[model samples]
Target chain A: MDPGTVGKLIAFCNNGQMQVPAPEPATDPRRHAADTWVVIPLYNEISVIARVVGELAAYFDHIVCIDDGSADGSAASAEAAGARVLRHPINLGQGAALQTGFEYVVGRNEADYIVTFDADGQHRVEDALEMLDLAKSQDLAIVFGSRFLDDRTDPGWLKRVMLKTVVWVTNLTTGLRLTDAHNGLRVIRADAARAIHLEQDRMAHATEIVLKLGRTKLPWREYPVELLYTDYSRAKGQSVLNSVNILVDLLVR
Target chain B: MNVMWIQLLLVVGVITVGLFLARPTGGDSHLALRRLFMAAFVIVAILSILFPQWLSWLANLIGVGRGADLLLYALVLAFLVFVATTYRRNVATNRKLTLLARQITLAQAATEDSASIHRPHEGTSNDDAAH
Candidate 1:
């Protein structure tokens, strides 16, 4: 979380102190935006999915929601909101849904980048667009959204500690030092996304993803993004004890 | 102090087997090893049943106070192994299920996309004919 560490990571990944220039207005940000697919793994968030999808629909033409067998009409809502919806016959957890989205997007030849967004309304669309732009402009294969890079997102004291611990574990296992371990917002170019085959069908997939993406050895950078942890998102947020399950899953498999 | 050796052996055996089974490998050799272990277990069961005195003699050699105690320890160890193997199998099964479900979802999506595309084309073709 330290600025010095982030600077070192940026230097190491870029192999020099490179500055990211602001996106030029003449280039038109939406020129290639159609090639970016926003993949949302929907579980039971019926109340906010439509709004989330609607917001994303404004920028990205290809927004796919993988509905993980929600009993509620979340898939219908997402579909009605002008986004493509893929439904699983049964609930297979978030990781499975994300993998389904990844496979589906990669199978299609249109998308150049896949943005994995959450359904809980925690992530910001603006941040997603910025990350996509950064990936495109910098020619980076992966850009992970890290809330800890800045003080904009306050995840509380305990949650902060737990997240830091998870990040430590993730970095140790993946050999990629990231400030955030489980943030759902990521921009993955199609080539790097193709290299990912996530077998972790649960929360552990967060760590598994970092490990697999690291193995690809593609250029990656962590971008500072604000996570709007509303009351709804906080209610649906992962409990600190779930980290134990993630650890066991990583160790046993 | 006499029973220390049995405790040590049990602990070491449990840890070793747990570590060994934790590795992710599944094929004909792994299946064969599982069957060999089952065969050894069945032989031990038969020998203990046929020659109950031999169980006590072996237990004494291993520093266990009684044959029953040794049997209980072995049963516990076997139960743990069963649990471990079952958990691993369940994980493997879940992975397969995930892949299957993903394939179904993707296939269904593809069909829907094609159908929608065809529907729009049908509408446009009708418009062209009217023009």
Candidate 2:
């Protein structure tokens, strides 16, 4: 795929939904390890971290695993699987963990771009790579990974309803009409990552990032990515009640 | 004007208990202030109910028209104070949590560095994680 022609982005009004662009066609394996960094915030995912890190290590050399006080051996397994693991003594929520990773990359100038991937197997490595390619190709500051971009994953009826409500609320609050607002798979340019700050240490951080993006000069793109929702990940993922908590966190604090 | 000694005792007794319960719980000054504010509200309401004439006397001294009006003003002021203090406390707690997270992250980095130093060849197999 010609990187420049990928996505065919056209910004418009509320009536027009930004057609989520498809991922770029396969290219040479992205070997420039000095440019891209992947931040995976791991909790109690001992069974999954090793496989996740191993796969990420194949495509990108800089894999940063942030262990959020997992009582399981997630950190050890990730480290053994060739990941630069950073740990927290206690659980500080996903927002804080991602911020810590962002600071690590932005503060040290480690990579040109940073990708936030899930510790669980719900997110696909292909989508992350594609987003990274799109961001680099378009010179965009951020590229958000979306599931509903195409008929990729079946997230059930209840989850589908909850996702729409969240997207609507997030769009209203953040002032950005994003197709999928709370998806974890995000690829951010280095400068935007440096300027961006995720302060809400809970799920509210997702909304915080979107709001920050709205307030920034960074240009962003959203690409259609497939989210492989496994039964294990489904059982461990955020609930609809957590969406309420995120809303309250945004409003009250 | 009649002075009921039993009424005075009840007022004093309730105020004392309320003040004691409202005492600061050591470190969290905001909680202490919240309890104290609630106690103040309860005590004032009790005093005014017991002696309307006494409340009116205080109101007149303070240039207020009615004792009920004075009580209403006090309640409003207490409620505002509670809200303002709660907001400040929440901000402080958020800042504290950020600091704690940063410290923990630093500690983790330090441990990882030391482990690499001690065992250069083990390649992250220290068994010091997730017990």
Candidate 3:
């Protein structure tokens, strides 16, 4: 929870996420009128949407939430949290929601960097600030937050094994020595992020982005961070077997 | 009655066409099964064509003249249906797998984005404070 530790985490992520510095003092900048924009792609996360948005809104200039056809009041909750809500007509999945957020950032002049956040309460807002700082400092095209760097805060045996396998396969296929290849936390330069078109409107879009980034040789960096797996997250989670399905999807797609 | 060669040719032609037409692409397991089905179809067709007299004799023994031809046709049709159904099921399963995979990928990206979104910055409320 230490902001300094968060900044060090960002630094670690920037430096190939190799050296994880101990938690430092939180010297990261506050929300500037011209700083980054936070984009939270939400579905049915009515319980925690407002808190997530309210927290991130304090540090970022704009908070845009793509309500991906949530049957619940996720959009209203996001709005209550002061997020500019964009609703999908139907459940177009998370990739489409994220693409909408990127589009919002690209169309606006106020955003220099774009941060993708989840609607679920799993991810903290402060991690976004660290990534923003790191992205700016390294002049990176894309900054991906990895959870595998700190061997201490690892997920259980099954997840660790599955993620390591995914990282291995992705590295083999894409030739990017990235650990935790499936971690979602990322900060992208507005132009660069927008330039990366996410064609797959489903989960495969994540793999697509990594592959495209490697193919394009965009200056990318991976940072290590902790994964907040709440009871709710554990309940709503997909099984590790889905990783094989993802691989097959990548093959067919 | 003596048109056994013609019948044999007919069976061979049908099998050749089936093999040429339904060229499915997938893993080896399915390829093996499809090959077996093709082989069975070819054998059945050849048996029915080459020995019409034998088929007629078998039918008479079973109290149904020329019934073996009907039986052969039924068997082939049933086998073909089964193979076709299996292929369709596999295709549907693969499609669903594709969709599920896509959803997982997006969820992961959203997760990464969420983490990056939460990192603490100076001057902001201590949101990163441990619960």
Candidate 4:
């Protein structure tokens, strides 16, 4: 695996995220990055964290990168890239990292919006910003970024079928019609986002989020986004069995 | 084909996994009970491997239909109990470990730049949305 690509993949590492970025001197409220906390769960993405976080910093101010016990200096790279870095003593799943980010924002009560972004290069910064705006303008509680919502990109046949199956299962269990069940980009309101506490410490958290939000009065929408599926990301993407495990986790736990 | 071979293969494969699990590591207290338990299984498994007909003979005396059937029933029951107990322990351990990791992350925040932790956002407007 390309170290940089793989580094982005495992960022499924989330710290008690949702850290408010230190504000810039002066900026437009519409474009303000501070009150919007972007949670980045990072594991061993030492190679690409700085670049990804740096690109994210262009739009949002407070970028919290959770380092889930990486042997490499992933946290350091994110910190250097103007993100607040939180450290986990051991490797927890990406779900735990996002939980940490959510809890941090809840604890501080300083953020207005919390955005969950993938550590993988698949996520586009432009898409995140647009989803953030849609969530705010439409007064929606959550804006889930869906690769299938629009035709900007294709995640390939096998991936499409896998994701569709996940979406189907998620909708069946949650009773919510979501175009994408496990895309890593999500923008949630502070209050509504706070209710999304994750117990599933692995990829199941994605489905778990759908279930949690579906039970609430939270209004949500799916925004179309693009995912750059390189040969690396395609190969490194989740195995089909992980979906079965996710289903079992959701049903049992 | 003789069913004995399948039973032998299954037991051998399972024992290989057991051997890996029983490999010694540093700082682990040696448990005599555990050693004894595994030793008993090893002996029984070897006995079954060596004397396949003995199980059927014993089973016949106990009114069981066949030796392989008796052995399979015993193995399945044992496996079920073992899985149930092991799963319970694994869940508990995972919960405790997750809590520890969560605490470690919550208690500390790292920034690339020194003196960046808790650096207040300047002239920040209202607390974004939620009060």
Candidate topping lDDT: 1
Q: How do the residues A25-59 of candidate 2 rate in per-residue lDDT, one tens digit apiece? A: 65666643568999998899988889999888888
Which model, 2 or 4, shows the larger TM-score?
Answer: 2
**Could you tell me the lDDT of residue A33 within candidate 1?**
61
On residues A113-171, what C-alpha lDDT tens digit does candidate 4 reach at each position?
A: 99898776679987777676656654879878887756777877877888898889899
Predicted model with the maximum DockQ: 1
Please tell me which model should have the higher DockQ, number 2 or number 3.
Answer: 2
1 or 3, greater by TM-score: 1
Ranking by lDDT: 1, 2, 4, 3
Write down the C-alpha DockQ for each prediction: 0.75, 0.23, 0.04, 0.26
Per-residue lDDT tens digits for candidate 1, residues A1-253, read: 4676566546645643222322333345465468999999998889999999988887788999999999989999999999899999999988899888888899887889999999988999878887777788669999898998768889999999999998999999899989999999999999998999888889999999999999999998888888998989998999999988988888887
Report lDDT per candidate.
0.86, 0.77, 0.69, 0.74
By lDDT, the better pick of 3 and 4 is: 4
What is the Å distance of residue A115 in model 4 from its true position?
Answer: 0.5
Better of 1 and 4 by lDDT: 1
Error of 2 at B26 (Å): 23
Supply candidate 4's per-residue lDDT for A45.
76
Q: Which residue runs does candidate 1 get wrong by more than 4 Å?
A: A1-32, B1-4, B124-131
Q: List the residue pairs that clash in candidate 2.
A: none
